[model samples]
Target: MSALDAKKIAEAEALMGQVDSAPDEYAKAGMYFKAATAYRLAKSSDKSKDCFLKAIDCYENNKSWFHAAKSYEQIILLAKENGTLSEVEEYANRACSLYQQHGSPEAAAAALDKAAKMTESKHPELALEFYKRALAVVLIGDATHQASEFASKVSRILVKLKRYEEASKALKKEISLNLQTKSYGQVGRLVVALVLVQLAYGDLADAKKTFKKWGNRCEHQEVSTLQKLLQAFDDGDQELAAKVLASPFIRHMDVEYALLSKNISMPQCIQNGI
Candidate 1:
């Protein structure tokens, strides 16, 4: 180890000794916290994390909710940097719950949001739960932007999971929020997305009704392309559907197109005669 690292390790050892000899829970927690800082400086991340956890336990024993929450936050950051995803989620959830208990709804929501993003790719169901928790907290705090963004994310994940009904509900909330904010352009796009979800769910009649209700609000090019794509699906013309999907205007609806593709048969034109 470098000289500086050695010095820090020595300082950590001194603090650890002090922790063992501390007269009260508060004193012990402080020493452990200081030792954790020294271990971080010594480039011993595992040791630092352990010390931080010890400090958190001591703080909790003393009923210092805020301090315990802060320690959990620190452990979460450390776990994230180490790419220990399970630990990151565990500590983040703990910290968020503690923050909520402390009446810091914004901090609680932010923590859950971070955990949701971190777990979205590998653990989508868990991420969905976290996003829902975050949305609940954000709604209580009047954070429109976070609420809308998180709801959109939840809808996307639900779509991926083929939970179309839940996805539709989430998208409806997002669209309503967009309307409330007078974000007419985004609301138009979201309405188109809602129709796509309905189609994917095999609610063809409802999809048609939604398109008739909101199609004109979207850009003409987008509306025209989506209509042709929908018609190709309805006609069971996979070749035409593929062609429409290949067009740039409709390519951004990749997820919706994928769902549609699964339900349609190959075009007769592309098949050899029996």
Candidate 2:
């Protein structure tokens, strides 16, 4: 090794040793972190990671959640670069927990959301999981408006994945969330989404029950359209059902819902042979 390389590595070793005799947790953490940076500069990546972990431990010993999370963020970037998916997931989760413990739920949620959007196109299912975690983090605080935003995001992704049952459940919960926040105007739209999801999943009975429970909040046009659509299905009037679903109101609701409506093939009728 060159003289400078040897000197850098020796400095790292000395710094790491100093942490053991440090008088305080913060001092120990600083020493370990300095050793980690030196090791990284010397191209000893594994040793750098080890020193980072020790620094994180010292930070945690002092209840320094933000510093611990910052260290984890370094590990997360390394894991991502190495294509160590499981490690990436683990470190990301730890970082989020630490950020939350530091009373930064928005940061926790934004981190997950950023990861989700980055992966949404190629790894949609994983993206969906990330978004769900983000939603949970957002819910940890008193941001009901933020909750509504994430609820819409989660349900839209669910609809795109054609997970109608999960979409229905998400929409139902969102409706309740909106009602609790006195966002009464949103309830009708969410109820429509829930009922549409139930119908798409061939759970007509649940659709009727949902409409009956929340139909009073719907605008007149929505009420008439949904009533006609449900009746068309019950009567096995496939053409009328298609017409109602293809109308501009349904088509322009949202891109996900538009696609979902297009996939709503003619409902099937079960005839009883008496």
Output the number of the lDDT-best candidate: 2
Evaluated against the true structure, the overall lDDT of model 2 is: 0.81
Task: Give the distance in Å from residue 86's predicted Cα in candidate 2 to where it truly belongs.
Answer: 4.5
TM-score of model number 2: 0.76
| Candidate 2, residue 97: how far the Cα is off, in Å | 1.9
* Candidate 1 lDDT by residue in tens digits, 1-274: 9999999999999999878789988889999998898898787999999999999999988887777888888787777677787777688789888888888888888888878887788889989989998888888888887788888888888888878888778888988777677677776667667766776665666767767776776787768866886787667666786787566654566475355435434345333321
> lDDT score of model 1?
0.78
Per-prediction TM-score: 0.79, 0.76
lDDT of each: 0.78, 0.81
Worst 10 residues of 1 by lDDT: 265-274
